[model samples]
Target: MKTSHNFKLTAAAVMLASALLTGCNQANSSTAATKADAVVAIPVEAVLTRQGQISSSYRTTATLEARAEAEVISKATGIVQKILVEEGDKVTVGQLLAVLDNERQQYSLNKEKAELSRLSSELKRMEEMYQRQLISADVFEKLKWQFDSLQASVSLAELALKETEIRAPIDGVVARRYAKVGQLVNQHATQSLFHLVSNQQLEAVVHLPEQQLAQARVGQQAMLQFAGMTPVNAELVRISPVVDASSGTVRAVLKVANAQQQLKPGMFAQVQLQFDVKTDALLLPKRALMSTDNTQTVFVIDSEHKVSRKQVHLGYQADNTVEILSGLELGEQVVIAGQSALKDEALVNVVTVRQF
Candidate 1:
């Protein structure tokens, strides 16, 4: 009886041991499976956050104009006798442009000159008579008045003769010519004979929105770009004081030096006005920022190859780069591409590293 009782006890102990060992092996297998599932790394491209310079700017459409423009008109009236210049001719101020018929004016001036000579001889004789007391003071004074009137008439005739020549009023390139040889032109018609433009310096005219008036100031640097041309530098020259009632905007003018005469008037342009610049700013590539539900976040990678979403504050944005005001450090790696599959505390495999 004692041997049989001992055997039963040993058999019960063995069964308990076997059940515990099986449970322990199952737990180990479950742990291994979980680790294997979490070890998969998300492939991503990343960039190192850097310190650099950034600028805030505004862009607007503008039209180029000449430094000075004028509509030229003739002051004399007669048949056009000769045309000295054509369109696109460069002329100086007071340069003769055309001539009118002056034959009648010349004849009138010669007749007036002869009359003045006769009056001067009579005045000399009258003065002699007055000195000898043979004529009264009133008679001498009347003869003097007659001679002065003839002299004035001759001066008027000379002025009329000179008016037959048309001259340029400003130094510029002639843009148009409305009169030709043998064409009749009149002074009172109120028509422009030529369009003159001074193109040594070009100007860009733009209407800035009223909200930007505080930032727009004279002497600021600007950049101008046109289709099929390289960008050029310009300076802000003028700003309108009053807002335009029709557009609710202020007019700003930028001046550009065209020493080589490559820029012409009436070219459409895109102007970039720089408002502010920052040096040594924390910057990141614009693609690194992800916007979700009005919230901006950046995926930052750690030394262990894990990514975490970090909320950031942004400052000035320039081109493809953005200034990071907070929540990021210089030299930290941020995922720039292949971010769609990333999550918090996710393992990542960096395929490429780029410098911002």
Candidate 2:
């Protein structure tokens, strides 16, 4: 009976051990299957890196100005007989703009002409006498001198009469009209009679930091922006040789063409001065740039769709593009979207690929 009982106990112990082993095997298989079916590829949006042109630009505030601007003043003193032009009148060069009273000037001119004619007749008679030895050489010379003086007086009087009409000195719009009909004006007047400006040729004047003088140069491209207006294209035309002592800034002038007359003088503008241009530069979308601890980083996707963190040196930045000085290559895929949750060596499925 003791033997039989020991056998039963040993049999029961073996059965329990077999059951535990089977359960352990099933658990191992399930865990293996779960591991094999785990998700690996993270969804991301990427762009192919490329070599392109990039510009290093400096942006500064500026003012739009007419290339040609002047204040017109009268050269003759007289009453403003007829104000031919009003404010905002467009006039061509030498177009009559105003007329002054010229009764006194015309009368004086006529009198001078009559005197000159008389002098010429007298000089002719005296010359004939001298040729026939009927007059003294001294008398003939004196008469000739008198005739020349009278001729000069006539010319002066004619000029005075011509000055009665005021003409536009340049092709432009009359920005302001300061004189009216019957108004007395003089050559010595301090104030101008008209303000003229040409919109055909425009300019953008910007004051930049003195230190940027070294980078500034003529012929570089510029962009002029104003509120509610399309941007105007311009080029750098002038740079101050000396810095402004009070402001510690340098004045830079950009030549602009306002053929449509859209840009006007004294309009506030925002200027982007493209000082430097780089061609065939390695470039990436700006969205791919990630900043951490003041460091710029980007994720580079390899052929296996695995992403790796890369530190890059930045150069010129234009719009939505950035120049990569180092740590990237052409044709490499850069993760621009869904980068916030990326990890090093993480697999990614590029759901969308954008052209550079």
Find the candidate with the highest TM-score and give its number.
2
Candidate 2's TM-score reads: 0.84
Positional deviation of 344 in candidate 1, in angstroms?
Answer: 2.1
At residue 251, give the lDDT of candidate 2. Answer: 86
Every model: Cα RMSD to truth: 5.3, 3.6
Residue range with the least summed lDDT across 10 consecutive positions in model 1: 34-43
Residue 138, model 1: lDDT of 95
Candidate 1 local Cα displacement, residue 186, angstroms: 1.4
Which residue pairs show collisions in model 1? none
- What is candidate 1's local distance difference test score? 0.89
Task: Give the residue spans of candidate 2 off by over 4 A.
Answer: 1-44, 291-295, 338-343, 346-351
Counting clashing residue pairs in each candidate, in order, gives 0, 0
Off by over 4 Å in 1: 1-39, 114-155
Q: Which ten residues in a row have the lowest lDDT in candidate 2?
A: 33-42
